[model samples]
Target chain A: MNNSQDLPLKNDIAARFLPLIIGLMVYVGTLCFVFTLFILSATHLWENQLRTQITLEVPASPGASSAPLQAQVLQVLSKTPGIQQASAVPKKEVETLLQSLLGTTLPVDLQFLPVLIEVSLNGREPIDIPMLEARLKIISPQIQLIDHRPWQVQVSSLINASVVLASTLTFLVLLTALVTTTFATRTSLLIHRQVVEVLHLIGATNEYIAKQFQVHALKQGLIASAIGAAFAFLTFIGIAALLEKAGLPSTSLSSFSIQAFCVFALSPFVTGGFMMLSARLTVMRGLRP
Target chain B: MSDFIAQFVGVGHQYKKGAEIFKGATFNIEPGSFHFLTGPSGSGKSSLLKMLYLGLKPTWGSIRLFGEDPLTMKPSLLPLLRQQVGVVFQEFKLLDHLKVIDNVSLPLRVRGIEAKRSYRDARELLNWVGLGDSLQAYPATLSGGQQQRVAIARAVITRPQLLLADEPTGNVDDDMAIKLLHLFEELNKMGTAIVIATHNQRLLERSPYPHLTIRRGTIIRTPKRSKP
Candidate 1:
């Protein structure tokens, strides 16, 4: 006949509020999920950049020239297995980096600055850090072998904590969405109890009544989640723009991977499907005699 | 098919608060029969009609509709039996949000019938009830008599095997009541069993159907008098 809904759900107060609540929850969840994705990508990029690189610091000697010790360290590194390249960091570049930190003034004599060396490994085999330290000590007892592994490990721990926090937040947001759907559906059933009873008396099955609620939930859920995801993507673009305006390198932001895009694309459908399921179950239980 | 459209054997009904409405009441509704269910208020007239339409189940004893025990039938299959039995509630339980035509065609729509066909049949029935122009109007906007007619149209839209009406003509005028009774008569002639529960003495005298009267929590059947 008219093909209109048997229940007047559109007029329900719950219907008006459900979409807004679901949209806000989806926004929070999408942000959390994207944050986790960004953290994971950044950690992966850092690991790849730091995996095969190490830095060496040669202290200045009072009675000997540090240039000779730096040259000896480079010679030793070149002869070692798995050592791809070795070179000293320019003293002037180090001095400029220090000036940026210490107000553009040389606090002490330039000769007192330690000689710094950059080392690259082939990455085919793991370097023996303790053995390298011993070898460097033979060259000069004041030499320091500073591998990047410890720093990377600390960064990894911090990133892992952030990912866990984001994931937990996303889970709680979704749970809240489900609870909201359930409560809204139940309230709708209560409000439309008489209409529902009329439908039941008119040869309508429970499944028929449930189908109405689920379809409403699905439509509302999809539109709300789409809006939420769109806002989240816009926020991402805004953050990227802000970073660029602040003179930060574009590479500092995590690039969107295919996985992240898929997550964003499927979020509406997933949320809608979940809401439909929740509404169906809540209506079924509420209609139970 | 069973000769009786409905059979109530040793049936009893009681409220949850332990108030027994009726006990050991037995009745059989044959196919294509029209009977008036009469009693004073609070005599379980509505309850009896409700049990016939599968809206309420007997607290004890057996009820067989369309040759199947409803109490023992699977809950999911109850709608199938309910579909075969149409009920017009005294309250005219129409959906307030739906337009008059939509409310009338709800039974057909619930059966998964095509919208065009169901709406056409609903429109024709509404025209017959003299509310053709009120198709788009909601139930809340209609008078009590018009709402009752809409309820009647909805009940008989499917041409069910058995029809149960509770005070079907209580809100309508004498003329409209007679017209509505004629509609039910036409349905009964088409092999539909009809049960009307009412206290209207004039309406009862107007028709020559047998009576199922309730007195002291028991049913007494008064067969139709033979024409002289």
Candidate 2:
């Protein structure tokens, strides 16, 4: 039967409120996704570029010709196998690096900090850090290797926390959407109890009654998801622009994987399906008694 | 199927934590027969009709509709059986939000009939009931008698095998009540079994149909007059 014309009870005031609520929730969820994507992409870039690099620091000898010692160290590093290249960092460049961190006002005692040398590995063979340190002691006893592994571990932990937080927020968003749909559907059932009775009296099946709510919820979900997804997309673009202005790595939206952005298109359908499922379950439970 | 449209043997109904509403009642209604149930307020007439229409199950004793015991009927089969029966309540029970035509077409729609065809039939029935101009008007806009007619139109739209009406003439004046009676008579002549529960004595005296009078949840039967 064409029961669509039977009545307009499905689209009540409460039903109208669902889309906006769901939209707000979806907005929150999509924002979480964007944050996680940004963190992962930046971490991946850092890993790729820094994994094969090492640094050596040389203490300035109090009374020796620092030039001769620097020259000798550079010569020994060049002779080591698996070392693709070695160069003494310019003092002025090291000061520039310090300016970025410690600012331009460097204390006179801090000027004796150390001379830094950057070392690159060919990546084809593994070099033991202890053996390399022992060999480097022959050129100068003050040479210390600074492998980036510990720093990488710290960065990995930070990325892991971001991902966990994003996943938790997305889960909460889904739960909120499900709870809201259930509340709306149940309220509608209570509000229109008389209508339900009349329909039941006329031999309408429980499935038919439940379908009324399902269609209404699906429509609302689609609308809310559209608004939420669109807002999320715009927010991501804005964040990308801000990050680019601030010189953060991987600031472009396309810099992330396609799966990262695909969420924007799929959000509405997922929420719509969630809404339909919630309505069906709620209506059936309401009608079963 | 049993030859009788409805049969009740020592049927009883009792509400939870409440006194008994049915006190061991027994009765039968033959197919294509028309009978009137006369009773005062709270005489259990509506409750008995409810049992016959599967709105409630008998607390004790055997009860059958269309020759099958409704007690053992599966829930999945309820809609199919309910579609074969029609009921008009004392309150008219019309959905206030639905228009007159949509309200009248509800039974057919529940039976899986297409709205296009049901609306056409609903329109014709509304015209027949002198509510043709009110087709597009909601049930809340109609008078008490008009709502009652819409309920009748809905009940009989599918041409159910049996029709049970509780206090069909309760809200209307004597003239309107008589007009509604003529409508029921026409449906009854078409081989539908009809059982009307009412408090109007004028109707009982004017018609030759047998009367089943209920008092204190007990029934007293009076045979129909032989045609001259």
Candidate 3:
């Protein structure tokens, strides 16, 4: 049923080595893809949470409780045409967040914590940031406006860099697999030169002989790719678990992105096809008298 | 595929022109004739066969196989033409990994015939060659004589229009050698054109087929005998 195994050179060193290298490439390729998805998911969530609001931080000053400054800023913001609504974050919430970050709030410095205000914009008006800054500065020179634009730019750049790196690695993995198949196919051709000669002598067309090698390559490619795929899948699960333990937002390695699932699913078939093509070409070239 | 299986005109061959291995050689075999090609060691017997099989183009002459110029034939067309020809190697070029039946069935398999479906023909041929019981055996496990028989079985299994063999019986005993010759005889009777290259002089006397002796890349035809 499977005729490629009937080929005498099937047990050659290169033949066995092909699957191992292909499997490793798939493993690394899957990791690169997974990391890219993780970045993408985190970036999307961060963008949604940060998109509509602007924040202002008011530092504590000597002999001045910032409650009055915060109320004045909010009153001024309410009068501004572009401001939808302005609200001051309670001091208790800020301290709770700082305690979680700094791991123990110093009792003495608790009252000295900065006052934070959130400003939501009405989409109908384009609020000028510098004008808002000058208006806020008139109330208190210590107020700092934190525009979300720079953060968005930085996040976009990071996401773009990661996407490009993942794509480059994917390209490299395919190239490596192709080179491995080509080299292995050539070696098999040379190893079985006499058998090939006999086949030729007996009236086998170059295509027929090439078909034999192609079938062999396809089988090998599929088998090796499956092994690689299984290993990659398991590694993703293990890495996801590790990431969860490290207190990071773990990627849904368990989350089936239909796109990623389809790509990984077709990888073995693509590998087999590549092997068949490369084998056909290599045999055709070798058969040239 | 054609009335004439092979034809050569001024067909001389050399790896390089002017430093010929053999030169200006011409020969032709009819559709169903059986012939022996005999010459000493290092003679051009193998080279001549190579040209006949389209393995090598003549350096400065013409070669026609199955009514097509081998030199001008499209590279893609060679396989179709080759399928009509069969060859048995002196080295017994059986794929050692394959079982005896598989080896014998390769010619048909290469042509896209289902190997399992063609088992009957392979079985019959192997049985006729005294290898019926060894169908499941590998070539490495077979003796030189057995390996040679497998090679012969493979060559003729396709019922090729032309069968070319190089020292097919070289490793066999004289009794087995005669038996092998008779197998070729049977194929020849079936209208398969056959040319056997051999160094065994006993076969030259044992049969009445024409001998196309090659001494220096040229055919020296022996006096004819009856085709009994």
Candidate 4:
């Protein structure tokens, strides 16, 4: 009999906290959705910028060696404030990448592959590629300074599109939360209407009733958010793995840094708080004449 | 611990100018005194009960309970005072969602009684009301007489000093009404003040105690208490 009596306590907990839990889960899920898109787009933009700094090509002529030309370009690059480190890439390494893309055997001579020099920059100021090209031409007319702004602009635009999309999704998620919270609170109040009346008749203050709802909503929100976060993380990891297998650009989805993850986790608490506020307002309004 | 359980002086109530429900109603229910309020339909029997239970304030004049004017009673203290007064509705307003035992035990629970003790008393009262086998049944599943029994059980479970019942036996058969009357008499013997509102002449004829009759929002026969 005693055990059975405690069962109602459990029921009370469930009834009070369930909506909060659901709210939290939805909040965390929305955050993860936005974060995943942001990470993929941001990393893609960063990688694209890294790839477009320079392009090199070598002639089939036996005398066409880039070693001396690379040395001269390095001298000019060292003096440039924005230039970080510049070094020539070995021909064999470039050949290997081509082989992976183009096949093991080729009709072309190995000398035709480019001796590429990789440039690292401070990214401080926009590179004056034309002026640098004129200076580089004085050392070796074959030397060219590549600005990479066209491809950078393209990648940046893609990043901007991603941001806009994520922001739109975030807005939709917030609106959904607001609607759900309002409806859930309203439904709960309706269900407990008589109990509310009884309490009022017996002299329970509005603040007391509001406190009960607040506690229950917060509890539900936190539990639901935790579940939602876990589910979103699992989905993110699963998608990242599948993409990796398909040879697409794959970064660690689980690599969501502490600060980012904290933001994601906090989303549920915010939702619960909103729900609590809505419930209090609804109850107060209903109690009024 | 107040000298007066309830007091109303010059109380009047009306609904939208149809007719005054109660006009210049003045009365006092002394501590531990039983009262029976009787009247024909629309004579404000229920309305007077409402004022006593704090459900409605008199349209005119002052009303007090527990020796304090209700209008000035702090809202926070209202629940504590109400917990001491229990009411049974004419329709047997039992919560249909709860089991009979649960419904009877509600007052105790609301008063912060531990479930273990409250349920023990609830089970005993259910048995006393001849509802021993139906403890787990919901109000909706019970017969009209059974539901009234459940309501009475709930009303008295808290051992309220004042118990107000409106038309408690109106829905029950004559035999069951007599049985419920004995139940109320037993509670009254135990020092709980009981007020039952009903139109049953046969039942009223059997009781030796005095009762007040209302007509046109006025008390025609005021019950006089014998001096202790």
- Top candidate on DockQ is 1
* Candidate 2 wrongly placed segments (more than 4 Å): A1-17, A51-144, A249-251, A257-261, B1-3, B16-19, B66-76, B172-179, B189-191
For model 1, residues A1-289, the per-residue Cα lDDT tens digits are 3667988887889779988989999888987898798778767877976888898989987767887788888888887888899888887888887887786654856688788888988999778888989999998788888888888888888889989999999999999999999999998998898888888888899999999999999999999999998887778778768867887566656456455567777899999999999999999888776
DockQ for all candidate structures vs. native? 0.65, 0.40, 0.52, 0.24
Instruction: Report, for every candidate in turn, its global Cα lDDT versus the true structure.
Output: 0.89, 0.83, 0.80, 0.71
Which residue pairs show collisions in model 4? Answer: A20-A220, A20-A221, A21-A220, A21-A221, A21-A224, A24-A225, A25-A224, A25-A225, A202-B79
DockQ of 4: 0.24
Per-residue CA lDDT of model 1 for B16-109, tens digit only, reads 9988878778999999999999988999999999899887888987889999988888888888999999899999988888999999888999
Give model 2's docking category. Answer: acceptable
Q: How well is each residue in A1-289 modelled by candidate 2, as lDDT tens digits?
A: 2345454655587667787889999999877876777777767777755777889998886656477777877787777777888887888888777789886676645447677888888888777778888887987787788989678888888879879989899889989999999998998889888888888878888888888788878888988898998999888878877876787655345657365578888889999999999999999998874
Report the number of clashing residue pairs per model: 1, 0, 2, 9
Residue pairs clashing in model 3 are A203-B82, A205-B79
DockQ for candidate 3, please give it: 0.52
TM-score of 4: 0.76
Q: What are the per-residue Cα lDDT tens digits for candidate 2 across B57-94?
A: 88898988887776787776777778888899878889
Sorted by DockQ (best first), the order is 1, 3, 2, 4
Instruction: State the local distance difference test value for candidate 3.
Output: 0.80
Identify the candidate with maximal lDDT.
1
Q: After superposition, how far is residue B138 of candidate 3 from its true place, in Å?
A: 1.9
The predicted structure with the larger TM-score, 2 or 4, is 2
Worst 10 residues of 1 chain B by lDDT: B219-228
lDDT by residue for model 4 over A1-289, one digit each (tens)?
Answer: 4223211222452255455546454655566454756566557656655644654232223666656766667788788767767777766787788888888876556675555677777677566677777787787666545556677678777866777777777667656665665566666667677767765554355665665566666666666766776566555556657767887544443444454456556666776676567657766666554
Off by over 4 Å in 1: A1-3, A58-116, A121-124, A252-254, A257-266, B1-3, B224-228
Alpha carbon lDDT of residue B130, candidate 2? 80
